[model samples]
Target: MQIPIINRSRHPLPAYQTEHAAGLDVHANLAEPVTLKPLQRALIPTGLFMAIPVGYEMQVRPRSGLAYKHGISIVNSPGTIDADYRGELKVLLVNLSETDFVVQDGERIAQLVVARHETIAWEPAEELSETARGAGGYGSTGMQ
Candidate 1:
């Protein structure tokens, strides 16, 4: 399936992949030096917009490199992008580490994954079936 992408700027950006069942990487370009103090939140622009198909959603996830190296991560990791939303894609980043994080323009900040979901009808049930580890919560799986 072909996905429409809008490049408002004069410069042409790399093509957005719609065939592959993978996430699209978003970049943040920091022309000047700026710091994101610990626990500080900021809106990072990706300079891109997309036309996503209906019945599908895009999940915004953080890049491992950015999280591990700079302690910068998506405030709402795996943020959902509804298909009907026709607006500029923005990244909300938060600095977790106790240091100022420098973000450069064109830096890969996060990834957008298109996913499919199923809506099910709910029918009230009297009870659920019993299991070997019934009602076991959290560490019920046992520590590795």
Candidate 2:
């Protein structure tokens, strides 16, 4: 399915995907650097904004290269962008490694994947059917 994206600027920046199966890469281009110290968190902004279509949302995920190479990743991995939101896309990055990280302009900080979500109506139930491992919590099954 084709997703319509509305660029808000006359000379709007382009969003790119390296490959057909790849997620759309978002960039942040500011005059000053966006640094994250050890265990520090900050919101890095992309110079551009987008208008995502209804019935769809954008999932912001970490770039494998950045996470593995620099220990930098999105604090809220797969951050959700609701359809109703109309603002600049910002990525909340955290530095888990013991060093300062610099986010440069036009850097592919995060990947955006379009996803479809469903809203379900809840119905109250007095009792639920029992299963073989009813009420099992974490590690209920043996770990080999």
Candidate 3:
């Protein structure tokens, strides 16, 4: 699956770290460092543009180490990049910890996973079938 991309940043292209890795690591492309105070969020640019295939989309996700270490996370988790978008890729980062965190140029901040998706058309129905868990909302299943 070869997707065309335009990378205008000084940082390297996002790549999978190991064999069978699902996501590629992406970095920040900034002229200067940005600081994020507690509960603050910013849109950090990646300086990357791509033409994703019609059947596929890019999913931006958080780095677990950053979230567990400095309490950093993506504001819109699993941010979706549609196939039609042709602009620079930006990441919405937030500081969930009490202390501030600095974002440096070319710092690995997120991961992008390319996945195949399906487009759905709603079928209007008058009634639906039932199941054992029907109408059971969040946490309705008891722990064993």
Alpha-carbon error at 9 in model 3, in Å?
A: 0.2
RMSD of each: 3.4, 2.7, 1.2
- List the global CA lDDT of all models: 0.77, 0.78, 0.95
Instruction: Give the lDDT of residue 108 in candidate 2.
Output: 78
Per-residue lDDT tens digits of candidate 3, residues 26-101?
A: 9999999999999999999999999999989999999988999999999999999999999999999999999999
Clashes of each: 6, 0, 0
Off by over 4 Å in 3: none
Candidate 2: residue 118 Cα off by (Å): 0.5
Model 2, which residues run further than 4 Å from truth? 1-17, 142-144
- Model 3: lDDT equals 0.95
For model 3 the TM-score comes to 0.97
Which candidate has the highest lDDT of all? 3
Q: How do the residues 1-144 of candidate 1 rate in per-residue lDDT, one tens digit apiece? A: 666888653334433446763766676745554578999989887667887788787789887778998898898888988888888788899999999888776767787777887667999999999997788888877644
**Per-prediction TM-score to the true structure, in the order listed:** 0.80, 0.84, 0.97
What lDDT score goes with residue 57 in model 1? 79
